[model samples]
Target: MKPDPSLAQRNLFLLHHFHNDVAKALHEHMREQRRRGEIPPYRVEPTPSGLPTLVKINESQRIVLHTRPSPLAPMQAIAQELSRQPPGATLIFSCGLGYLPCALAPLLNRMKVIVLETDYDILLEALRMNDWGAIMPSGNLLLLAGKNAMEEANILISKHGSLLKNGIRFFPGRILLDEETPTFTSLQTIARESQEIFNYRITSNLQVKKGSYAIVAGHAHKELLSVLCEEAGHVNMDARPVLRRPAVTQFVQTPEMWWESLGRPLPAKLLTFTNKAFLPSEWDKMKAFGIRRFLWCYDDPFRATVDDTFFHHLDRIYCFDPFLTKRLQKQSPIPVHFLPEATAFSEGAVGPPPWDIPSTLPVTFVGSTGLQRQDDRLPRLVSSRDPSYLTIRQFVLDALAKDERIHYDELMALPVEFPNFHKSARVVLLEDLATFVVRLHFLAALVNTPAKIFGDQAWLEPALVGDISRIYAGRNLDYLRQTPWVYQNSKININIFNVQCVNAPTVRIFDVMACGGFLLTEYRPFTEELFRIGVELDVFHSHEELREKVIYYLEQEEQRERIARAGQERVMREHRFRHRLPLIFAAE
Candidate 1:
């Protein structure tokens, strides 16, 4: 058949955004290959699919490479398969020219297509000859080819892994010759490997890394399991980070898809940050697959709005503070356990950096003041649209100023006038505003001391601090990995718990104590339960007391040393991650 100009013209027109990128990438790849005198074994030819493409020929050059008769049949097969695919779906194709991806664009309701071709030369030829002006944007249809195709394919799978509710629906384009031709065989192998990755993702089987215990973490709790993995126990801790809310919506929109992501049929439970109710409304889907959900929650109960029926979905709940535990127990029928922020103190715990390091530096606070004023939160607060919200927000903020404390049961008394007030918005707003006002008081009071603070620069602004260096210390390396080192070197590690959990100690106390560093923290009712007053650690309730204790500790080095030693001993004995997590998970 003579080359049809209309069809050829459509293929040649590049999606304007991808045109320069394709041309530049092709030119650079070809130039580099010429410099190395290594030409990619690919050439352009017209396929029976009625489009121009690069053919991976046998040495004899007689047969076209493919699993089926032609690429069009596979396109038809994929189209039919995709006709049933739900929205937020993704399709992965190997060895296909750009034509099919574009063809399927209109067929898909809102699906994304990823094309992984074997040769850049073919892609370069397609770009050179065809007018891809009719092609969809790079977002809807992606074309990846050439030497980096495999690497790009791997990344593509991971990036879109969370977006594929239907899992990875693969469309195979062609298969190169057998192993007798090493180059062709290797190229084909990579293509096959890419296909396998998609297959693993689309299926509903579990991929646990350890002996049935996989650590599933998200943004808030990624560091929660850090110490658990380093313990002296026989269990290996595997880190499996779940996607964020938006991306996850694409991959687990359906009940079956949700089950597949959790590695259905496997008895392993998932552990993630409590802040996100990843399956807020999709709990039944997970239960249908016999998958149990486990969560780690630490936020104040008022801020704990994961849908009213969220409790029925989870199998076990682990909370950071006793108060949070009590609130959760009242709302949930499942077992709710308390796990204080902990570190690994067993002999097998992580050792110090491989170098000579100082035992102490100066007085410093290692937390960010991430909260804003009442005005900043006003928009989200019910105060934005309703006048009644003012009374509720002020009441919550006042309670937080006095150190916020309210159980889940007490929340039912939230006026009830607005009907959706508590669940729809107020519960969350109260918790956030409470945190905001309290952080302001804590920082404002502590400014009298020369304790340097390390957090967001906003805390150092003129409104918050008059002397930047004395109050607002500079930032450090990545917070989690570098915090231990920062703690060990600080002379007196000061901690101020956020407003929400003022009645309970924050993780900073344990983190600093685990480093064998002296601690002078704001008073929490639970502090006495964990450490001795002025023995293992010092606590100050009032602003004047906080300043006085800083002066007293600076002068009494021996007492500070004793407290530091005692705190370390306590953590090593009873408060390590190895000790805490087992107890939480063990509670049947």
Candidate 2:
């Protein structure tokens, strides 16, 4: 059936919008990597094809990609072959020689194609050398490259899955189709087994079964264990957690082997992801395997920027911080619901209370100050490399407001180097500035008090160079055992919300209360919404005021204990992990 002209026009409009969105999404992923210091030096390799490709300059010296050369045009036979495919979506593996795209143009009337080109150099080559503006407006094509290509491909598949079910027309480039190159090989293998991949995902998506299973995934093994523990007690379904990768491949490299690892062809009622994109982008490929439900939890959305691409096919998208919830809601159609982090007393794992434990440890603060090193500054990527605090703050705020693709004209004497800094660079830089200055101010206030601080090894100041070592009690606490112990043992447990979330109670609030700790936290608009102020816990509006309240609470031990009990009672009754269920899962 032919489409109406107006509908076709709207599709063109949506496609044009998608081009900008994906470009910005890919850009944000790169900036976020640099912000977190995860970027490694990239090596350039020439391909038989006209342009160059990228490879990781690694110690192992693995050959990254394989491709062959081709001229400005592919033979007529190649064009005919592409046109023969049914009218639907085509998933191309490598951009390869760039000829396939031009060849596929005549078939554009029926085909919506997505090219997942991993070679960054080739993508840049196509953008600079070829007329991309002509190709992009077709409302039927997309090209993704660079560090986040695979993940971005998953997002595309999820968004266009209905069209993709028609079939895959893969073309491998310099990263030749070989077993040695896992990524390229995985695609080739999955293509060979496309029917199985499709079947498993669709089967899993069927209505829930009584004895079937749901999988829970996380960024780390420890996090998987944490969520696994919590869900074990709360869920009606048979919930299972596979620790991050290798354990759960999501049908990328070996679908059959993964199903064997899963022990059975169980239907997936729910697939819970720990907001770090922990569930991988290839999630669409696993849809046939019974992944009917997607639950994504953003424990710290502001600390890292949210990519709505990750929410392409998600069932429920939740963020713990109120600030993030509001911002994400504005950008996404999916309800960006606000759900505070939860905690519960794990009496079994943590044996008995410490013997002869001090009634109280010195005034304690148990979070790592967000700043790590100096390169984290926005000026690091700027042409002038200026680290002026005020300049960086304004730049980041403006950049985030503009969708993390800052215009060159937004700053004074801005460098010509950065075309656009990702929105997350702004987020990360802005967050660092807030944390660095705020921690310093609070630390100065506690210098006279015997305040004991516990934080990451990144906590490099005050003690070594800043000359405030007297109160720097050293190192961070283990979130599982040591933190709970500190909360229960400390006379006045302190909380500092991250600068990104100025108006919400962070998970730390629930953690401290669950452990029955006497609480003194930073003030926020939503703080009172969760707990009655003055009666449950005291909040500080400024460093001086926090110091005064710390003294007052310490002297009034009986009153402090009373407030602590009240806070604990509130958390026990309303803020456990189970309480967050109704917000994310409607039936719950």
Candidate 3:
């Protein structure tokens, strides 16, 4: 009893086009059933109505899928009932031989059609009985089966919840099992909640009138940029003042309140520091409201899980790294540009060295260890499994464990064999590992020296080789206020670049220089291009070079002061937030 070649081809087509986690589960179930020589639970038989019908083969009783006199009557009745409802997405709880979905085929062009079947056996029988090439390939149909069907449905709702605003109709189909009743009820509850949320969103958007400009960022970024925009007298091309707003993380209540406070006037040009600030539907609403959306990728885009859905909503994208910018420009249609990060303006004018005998501390570093442990559940790898089973997280940890100092080129060259793993996740894992290795390698050298490290508790973890307790300062310094003081007070401030940032100097370099602190930074081609090495700022390419520079700079007070002063002058003249504001606000 070989599997039918036509059924195999149809299954391949459906799985390939409408594939998801649920589909994969269903596929594996079908494969296992075929291997075990178990027949599907349902059988097809011709009826007197001239249409084939499905019969559930239960030991207790046989269940007919359609009415006796006319198998098409129930499907026609369901279609007529659907016509009375408002235009919106359609969700069918089960598919019995594909009759219901096939009858609703003409409606697929107008709305999304989602078919959820709890039993994989029934779905297989339906696939084998009918040709779904017309409905499945339309890009509007989503067929979900298996135990986790509810989870997949929730994801689809989150992505396209706005469509439910008009109306949502549910068809229980010709057959509903006792186990599937709960799933249908849960979907109804989710759709109702989503509609309520969208209603609130619409009301809020209606209140705002598009006019001025606003900045959406994290608390620290929002505060820093708001102050800088005021101090710099930032204005748009029309000479209208660019108004600044507070940071918004949730898309619901806070934005509504803020909009009301400002007399409900929406900013014509909205600049957001991160895409995670708002949900995808909120982006669509803002676009509908005539707000031109802009995003600045201060960190690597991969670190944020940025995808095409987010990219398509943005009008312009600015990135810090040249290599990433070029890569994104090639992949996305959005106008991507390279814009280096700049430091906030110093509160007051920087003066000469404060200490007569250079500070007692030889050097100070204020940054994260980048070695924080992740709580993500790593996919377990069974022995003798295929390489494609390896997830990005597992692959990264294994590679780093073997050689913590693996070259970036070698790491990038390694194949990402798993097709299910996303491109962003791959880069993010690599970036995290690279940062951990780079920071640990350089910071390990300072364990012997009198360098004070200000960061989280990751440094004191037993995994690290050296006893860093003496140098590890508690938690963090306030980036806005305390960081500058520490920079200005220290004899030498060390700046280590994360490997993820290919050709861009970290903001630490600019901030240290702006505070008139002698910066001994990691050597990067962009750093050398921006400032004169050893003249404006000194750089080190290796651990030995770092230690040598730190020792040399501490011993020479005159040379340190000369270089620090020159760096501060350059930063104040060219690298402050004021200098970068124009480019950010410039029209395409």
Candidate 4:
């Protein structure tokens, strides 16, 4: 068999960008088939539209990849099918000849599309028939080829868990192989199960609104926002439906039931922390009920499977990270604004406990050590054995370890190129790994110092390497009540920003300042934009600087008091949750 230049180029491209094991397996299988003088299972055919199509040749039967003359005919059907479904991730059982993904590329802006093929031979034939360079690098399309449907499904869940959100839709390719029947069936089952779980979780958090504004968020945000809204004379309602009820029972009163329970006049607006608060259908119902939907993303949107489709339901989006805000503005039709996290405390909010100068800790840090559950996330990248991912990970870890001040945007925009390295979930994983490294590097220096770490037993792990157990405080702190007390009483509160939060100070900065505590925080590009560097809140550029600041501030009690007072004033005047409400509702 002669080596076709086009097919060889395509195979090489696949090997460069995709999983090496799958590409190598296809190469060896094709070589063995050629040696046996066996014809390829699929052959390319010219369509009347001057486009190539695929035709599968079995023992005595011919199966066309598409029945219509134009290769795009199947795409029309797919588009029509998609029009009826709600916005979310898509799961295709098979790739067929790769035309589906290729044709759907323009429509898949930020949407996650997973292609699972049971037969590697068919996948190999598809790779040989088409050029996947454009679609492959977009990072939205994932191709998984495995021995069986169950195996592929497991891989999909393990690697791309974010895509399994509530509204995921499953589709069998137009030309499904006999071997792919089980794949299609099993994947549909998985999708159904995922939807059920999502429905339960969303419905479990459903509340009936008493105020003109409804907030759907995690426990902390929900409590904070509820208080803020009510304090502003909104009389916010706590719409708890039922407590500790089974999911089976919760479904009896569907999300629509709660929405209808809001009575004839619905809330003036609905504010949700993330897209996970409601189902696609529920979003539609809310939109139909004339309730404006606004989303505030605390996490980096790029780190999750959220895409443009998810934004279609939202009227406005406020992102905590500036880098992501800019990225989302370009990709989403909705208005994307930069809104940093704010302190929940108001101007005259009372502290949980009276501030005691004598009992105050010298230095305190409140947050997770990111090291916990670190191993669970590494398996996906490690198992792939992709040198590109490994190289990028090591490069980032080394760069961050050398200089903790290296900006996340700099790492992301590094000039060094690797084929399709940035076009996968590995980049997100790299962000997490970089954060852990920077956090460990800075926190380890505080081992001998008087800095006491709170939250997560991971600090006591071997990574910190000291009598960290003595410094490790309780696992949890009441965010609304106790956290403010800790921040208020501490002499110097330390804040370490996650790398993924490129140019923004985290909620901890605002919280500590709101509590009138002197803060020594890691520097961020936008730190100056938010506060006076030395007057309001101090920032440290290195571990040595952090330690020096800790010692210096501990001794200069008057200086600490001045800075703490300034920070508290700045936060109460401009960085409270009440201040954010106007900016959020202004879009209306």
RMSD in Å for all candidates: 12.9, 12.5, 15.0, 16.0
Residue-level error in angstroms, candidate 1, position 111: 1.6
| Per-residue lDDT over 172-272 for candidate 3, one digit per residue giving the tens place of the 0 to 100 score | 76666577678778888888887786566656635444445666654224357566656446433221222221111221222333332222356666666
Ten-residue stretch with the least lDDT total in model 3: 375-384
Whole-model Cα lDDT of every candidate shown, in order: 0.55, 0.56, 0.66, 0.65
Deviating ranges (above 4 Å) for candidate 2: 1-215, 219-228, 231-237, 246-267, 274-281, 286-290, 299-308, 344-359, 373-424, 463-467
How much is 382 displaced in model 4, in angstroms? Answer: 11
Q: Which stretches of candidate 4 lie over 4 Å from their true place?
A: 1-211, 219-222, 234-255, 258-264, 347-358, 373-397, 400-428, 463-470
Model 3: colliding residue pairs: none
Using all chains and alpha carbons, the TM-scores for the candidates as numbered come to 0.59, 0.55, 0.55, 0.56
Worst 10-residue stretch by lDDT in candidate 2?
246-255
lDDT of 1 at 421: 35
Q: Give one digit per residue, the lDDT tens place, for model 1 in 265-335.
A: 34355555553445555556555645457777756544545545667677887877786677678877778
lDDT of 4 by residue, 247-361 (tens): 1112222444434323334566777776755556767877776678898888788766667677988899999988889988888987889998887765322534543323567
The alpha-carbon deviation from the true structure for residue 364 of candidate 1, after best TM-score superposition, in angstroms, is: 1.4
Candidate 2 local Cα displacement, residue 358, angstroms: 5.7
Model 3 clash number: 0
Model 2 C-alpha lDDT per residue in residues 486-533, reported as the tens digit of each score: 887788988876665546677788888888888898777787788888
**What residue runs in model 1 are displaced by over 4 Å at the alpha carbon?**
1-108, 113-194, 197-211, 219-227, 232-246, 249-265, 275-290, 301-308, 344-360, 372-429, 445-448, 464-470
